[model samples]
Target: MLIDRTHRPWLIFSGAGLAVAAIGYVMYSAMVVGGPRGGSAVGLTYGIIGYAFMLFAGLIGLRKKYPIVRVGRATTWMRGHLWLGLLSFPLILFHAAFSLGAGSLTRALMVLFIVVIISGIFGAVLQHFLPRLLTERVQLETVYEQIDSVRGQLLEEAEKLVADLRSALEGDLSFAEEKQRAMAASAGTVGGLTFASGLGASEFTSQIVADFFDQQLRPFLLHSGGHHCALADKGQASGMFSQLRVQLPRNFWPKLADLESLCDEKRGLDRQRRMHHVLHGWLFVHIPISYALLLLAAVHAVFALRY
Candidate 1:
């Protein structure tokens, strides 16, 4: 992951600090209370320290929301969020004397805290790899929000291609008709001429092209979520275009090739959209749960102090 080297020092520092705190808690428990107890002064110290780390980790989210705050490098804040956030778990366990609290509120806080930590870890893992997947797989990637505009442009191009194909085919038919008339006039015999060698064949070809566009290309280009369409599949789209090249005049082959490329680019953009959604989707689960966890922890702390 790109974050490895930058986060290494932070990871080490947090790990060492946690080890020291755990050892100190162990020694104090052995010397003082005969066992670790959450009500003890040492346990309260561990709780305060752990909660401080948690608060710092949570602030990273605030920092992201307001980048203009200019407190520190985002990378530094991210590293702290990752390493110190992980360290908070063990510290909180130490605070509770490695026991689940007896009260219902404390149990709920523990469950919520575990869910938040697990979701954060899951999100961090996704961030590490999803960007690389997007870069390698989506060469024509654009801003996700701009996809609709780009899609409309692609649709316009596809429509223009169909129009050009029809125009070119009609022009071919007119030329063939003119040439046949010239031949018949020279020979002075029209009754023996076969219809297959003239305008009728070109008209047939135009109809075939029009039908293909209406049935296949139009739906693929004009619809939202064309990713589900047959043309969105690379092999199928390529084969369909190959068949089109065979059916259309050789002169129109280049335009068919260009259309194939546009389709592929549209497909790539769709993939990028899906991947971008995946990269962010976890936050929907993580953020709200984290806020809930924090709120529960605050309430638990208040009740503990009062009772």
Candidate 2:
């Protein structure tokens, strides 16, 4: 269940009631029969009901695959799947008479079922907490599938910013040099002044800006995960940008600010991508094992009936 609102209470109540009823039936069978044997009539009934619940639980995945089918609200199906899937384990245990059956195939099926249940529960727990964590942390949250394209756009924006800064700095440097030349020529004619200093400062600042982008900002923004870059470390990025701000002229501060903002956005995108992975990673384990469990259960059913 999600961390925000509680899941439907009635669903939980109904599943628990049914599970309790099934448990009572199992107890009755245990008393009536010499013991709760898997091949007994009551045990077969439990197996059929347990398999039905498993089928219903598996349909939730199918429903997700084709969401256009409006049989019911998705939340309804998910709630049912979660509760009934949980309930199926107890039913299957009842079917097995709380023990593995007398054959290797039965034992494998039981092990597979246990693994499937554990994976499903693990996935449920992740779904419950990870979304809330993401909401709290990533204000710049985006559709996960679009993260790559968004990242490319961010890189393009950063490149354009650097290009604009380069153009501005070059223009300023040219104007400064031209002014110094005029001053030099006038002073030589007048024979009253030597060459003025600080003519090359803008040029030096431009080089620093270019190197900063090429070495740090560009690589950090372009990467999917920000782990390898120094700017990925917020403290390091802040300090590096602070040093660059002190080095560059005051006129370039606005552009430097924009670059810093872009870096921050890139860090948010990186965090979002990682959290998205944490959110969905468990499906890799839960899904395939579920199908395998169902297939093995089918084979076991066939063999059990034949014998």
For 177-263, candidate 2 gives per-residue lDDT tens digits of 344345543332112112223223456667888999899999998888868899999899999999987876665677678889888
Q: Mind giving the per-residue lDDT tens digits that candidate 1 earns over 180-254?
A: 445532332232222333333366677887887788777887776686688989999999988887886565677
By TM-score, how accurate is candidate 1?
0.84
User: Each candidate's TM vs. the true structure?
Assistant: 0.84, 0.84
- Runs in model 2 with CA error above 4 Å? 1-6, 22-26, 29-34, 172-200
Q: What lDDT score belongs to each candidate, Candidate 1 first?
A: 0.78, 0.77
Ten residues in sequence with the least summed lDDT for candidate 1: 188-197
Prediction-by-prediction clash tally: 0, 0
Candidate 1 pairs with clashing backbones: none
